[model samples]
Target: MKRVLFLFLLIGFISKAQVKPTIQKDDIVRIETTLASDKMEGRQIFTTGVDSASAFIEKEFSKVGLTYYKGLKNYRQEFVVRNASANNVIGILPGKSKPNEYVVFSSHYDHLGKEENGKDKVYNGANDDASGTTAVIALANYFKELNNNERTIIFVCFTGEEEGGFGSKFFSESINPDDVIAMFNIEMIGTESKWHKNSAYITGFEKSNFGTILQNNLKGSKFRFYEDPYLEENLFYRSDNATLAAYGVPAHTISTSKMDSEPNYHQLSDEVSTLDFDNMTEIIKAIAISSESIVNGKDTPTRVQKIR
Candidate 1:
C-alpha cells in the first residue's frame, strides 16, 4: 500500500513537472497592450482610466474562476484615499492542503496620467507596470490550470504605487504577516534586463534566500534571476513589496528596468511599442515555474528582517 502511494505521488509530480509554459505570447500581448493603451489614460488612481483597468483585471480573474479575497464580496479590495476612493484588484485560489499558508503575487497597475501637452499626453507606462500586472494575471491563469498548490495563492494589482504604496500598505495590514510565506512582486519586466533576455534581478536578494531558491528551481532553464545590480538606488523598498518586507515576509521585487538609463522610465515614450512581448512572456513563465515549489509547499524561504 505504501509503494502504491509513493508511485501515485511520483506520477503526480511528473505530470506537474512536464507541464510547459502554457501562457502564450499572444495572450500576454493582448493583456499588456490593453492595459497600456492610450484609451486607459495611463491608469491613474482615482480616475475613470484606473477604474476601467481594475474592471478589466477583475474580468480576467472571473474568467480564471478565482474566488474573492477573504472578507470581500468581490475581487475589488476597496479603501479610501483621503476623500476619494481607490482599490486593489485581488483574487485567491485556496490551497488544496495547507489552506492557511499564503503565497502572494503582486504588481501595481497605477501610472502617470495624461499631461497638459498635446504631444503624447498619454504616458502609457507599458513597461513601468502594465507589463508587471499582465504577468500577475498570466501567472494566476497558469496556476489555476495546475490546481495543485498546497499554499493559497493571492494575486493582487495594487493602486497608488506612483503616489505611494497605499494599496499594499492596506493589504499588508489586513492580513496576518506571519501567515504569508512569500511575496513575488513583479515590476517593469517588459524590457530585457542589462544582462539581456530571459534574465531578471531581485531586489533585497541578500536579505533572504528567496532568489537562491528560485534559481535552484530553474536548474535546466536558460532564464536567470540575479541579485539587484543597482543596489545604490535602493530598489528593494521602492515598490509595493516594501510594506510586506518590513513585516518580515520574504517579499522581493523582480524587475529588469535599468535605473541608471531606462530611456522610457516615466517618459511619454513608455509604450507597448518599446516592449519585447516574447521576452516578457518568457519572464512570466520563469516566474511561474520558479515559484511552483513554494506554492506546492516543498520549499520555504528565509523571512526578511522586520524593520517596523
Candidate 2:
C-alpha cells in the first residue's frame, strides 16, 4: 500500500509539472495597449508604424533576457524582399538540453498603413494580428519566467505579412530548415470563435499532424481546436505560416477569424475596443499549454509534406 501511494504521489507531481506557464493578464493588456496605440500608426509596413513596432519588440527582448542568436551582436535579423526593407525580430531562449533544435513562435506586426480617403488614416489592425503580436510578447515573458525548455524557443515578430508574407519567406530561407522543428504562427485571435466560445482553429490542419498533437495536448480543456473552416479562403497559403510551410516545416496559423462574416477584418473599424480581453487571455493560456510539449522536446509535430 505504501508503494502504491508513493507511485500516486509521483504521478501527481509529474502532472502538475507538465502544466504550462500562464501569461499574465496585465502583461497581455500592456502589450496590446502599446502595440495598438495610435503612436505606432497601426504598424504599417514600410512606415513609421513598422519602425515603432520593431523598437517595441527590441525593448521587450532585452527586458525578457532573451539572447541574440549566438555569434550575432544584435537581435535584429535584417533582410529585404522585393525592394522593401523588412526584418524579423529574432531572439533565442536557449534550451536546457537540446539548444540547437528550435520551436518558433511568430506573429506579423504589419498592417494596412493609411487608408485611401486620407482622413480616417489609422488602419489599426488590432485583431487582424496585433492580438497575435501581443500574445507572442506575452508568451516570451511567460517562458522567460519558467526558464526551463529543452528545445530553443525562437520568438519572432514578423513584418510584411500583409505584403506577401515576405518577412517569413526571407527568414525561412535564412535559417537552417533542418534545425527548425515547428512554427506556431499566431494570427487574428482577438475575437471569439464560432465553435466553442474559447475555441480556435489551426490553418492547414489536414496537411500536417500538428493540429492533432495540439488538440490532444489540450484535451479536457474548454478550448477545442479544429481545421480552418474558411479553407475556401485558401487561408493556409494566406498568412506568414505559408512561407515556412512551403519549406516542409509543420507551420500553422492559430486564429479565431470568421473570415466569411467578420465585419471588422482589415476595415477602419477594426479597433482595439472590439476585442474580448478575458477570452483573449484564455486563448493565450491555451496556446501556452498546447505548446508545452513542443517546447520541452517531448513531442515533435509531424512535418508538412511538400505539395506538388
Candidate 3:
C-alpha cells in the first residue's frame, strides 16, 4: 500500500516536470505598442505621461492576477521624491512554498520628459527605457501564467530613475532588504549586442555570482549571457539595481545597449520603428528562462559585495 502511494506521487512529479514554458506573442506586441503609444508623452517623471503609464502598468498587473504589496489597497507604492510625489508600481506573485524569500524584477518607466525645439519636443524614449519597461511587463505576464514559483516574485516599475534614481531608492529604504534574495533590472534591451548575437550583458558582472549562474542556465538555449563590455560606462551602479546591491543582495542590470555606438540612443530618432522585435523577443525569453532556477529556489546566486 505504501509503495503504491509512493509510485503515484512520483508519477505526478514526472508529469509536472515535462511541462514546457512559453511566452505569448500578443504580450510582446502589447509591449511595443504601449511603449510607442503617444499618450505616454515619453513617461516623464511627475508628469501626466508618467501617471498614465502607471495606470497602464497597474492594469496589466491586475490582468495577471498578481497581488498588491501587503497592507496596500492598490498597486501603486506611493512616495515622495525631491518634494515631488511619485510612485513605484508594485505587484507580487506569492510563492507556493517560501513566501518570505523574494526575487525582484524591475525597470524604470520614467524617461526624458520633453525636448527643446518646441514642435520636436516629444521624446519618445522607445529604447532608452521603454524597451526595458516592456520587458518587465512581459515577464510579469509569463511568470504569472506559469504560477509555479517557489519564491515570491516582485515586479516593480520605478519612476524618477532619470532624475536621480529616487524611486528605487525610496523602495529600497521601505523594505527590509533581507527578504530580497535577487534583483534583475532590465535596461535598454531593444538592440543587438556587440559580441554575441541574440545575447545580452549583465552590468557589474564581476561583482556577484548571478551572471555566471545565468549563463549556465542558458547553455542549451540560443541566447547567451556576457559580461558588459562597457564597464567604463559605469552602468552597474547607475541603474535601479544599485540601491539593492548596496544592501548586499545579488542585484544586477541586464541590457543590450551599445553604449558607444547606439545612434538613436537618447535621440529624437529613438522610436519603436527602429527596434528589432526578434532580438527583443529572444531577450525576454532568455531572461524568463535564466531566472527559473532562482524563482524556484533551486539556485540562489551569491550576494553582491560593493566595491565602495
For all candidates in order, the CA lDDT equals: 0.95, 0.86, 0.87
Tell me the TM-score of each prediction against the true structure: 0.94, 0.90, 0.91
**lDDT by residue for model 2 over 1-308, one digit each (tens)?**
99999999999999878565677778887888788877888788888888998899889989998899755688777876677676778888999999889999999988987666666678888897899999888889889888778999999988988878878887887787778899999999989887847799999999878999899899999888888999889988888888778878898999998888889998878888988888899999989888889999999988888652
Global lDDT for candidate 2? Answer: 0.86
Clashing pairs in 3: none
Look at candidate 1 and tell me the lDDT of residue 45. 92
lDDT of 1 by residue, 1-308 (tens): 99999999999999868464398999999999999999899899999999999999999999999999999999999999878999999999999999999999999999998998887899899998999999999999999988889999999999999998999999999999999999999999999899999999999999999999999999999999999999999999999999999999999999999999999999999999999999999999999999999999999999999998
For model 1, what is the alpha-carbon lDDT of residue 169?
Answer: 95
Model 3, residue 46: C-alpha shift (Å) = 0.9
Q: Which candidate is the best by TM-score?
A: 1
Better of 2 and 3 by lDDT: 3
* Tens digits of lDDT, candidate 3, 67-149: 99876899999987668889999999999899999999999998887765676676788887888888888888889878789
Question: How many residue-pair clashes does candidate 1 contain?
Answer: 0
Error of 1 at 258 (Å): 0.8
Give the number of the best model, judged by lDDT.
Answer: 1
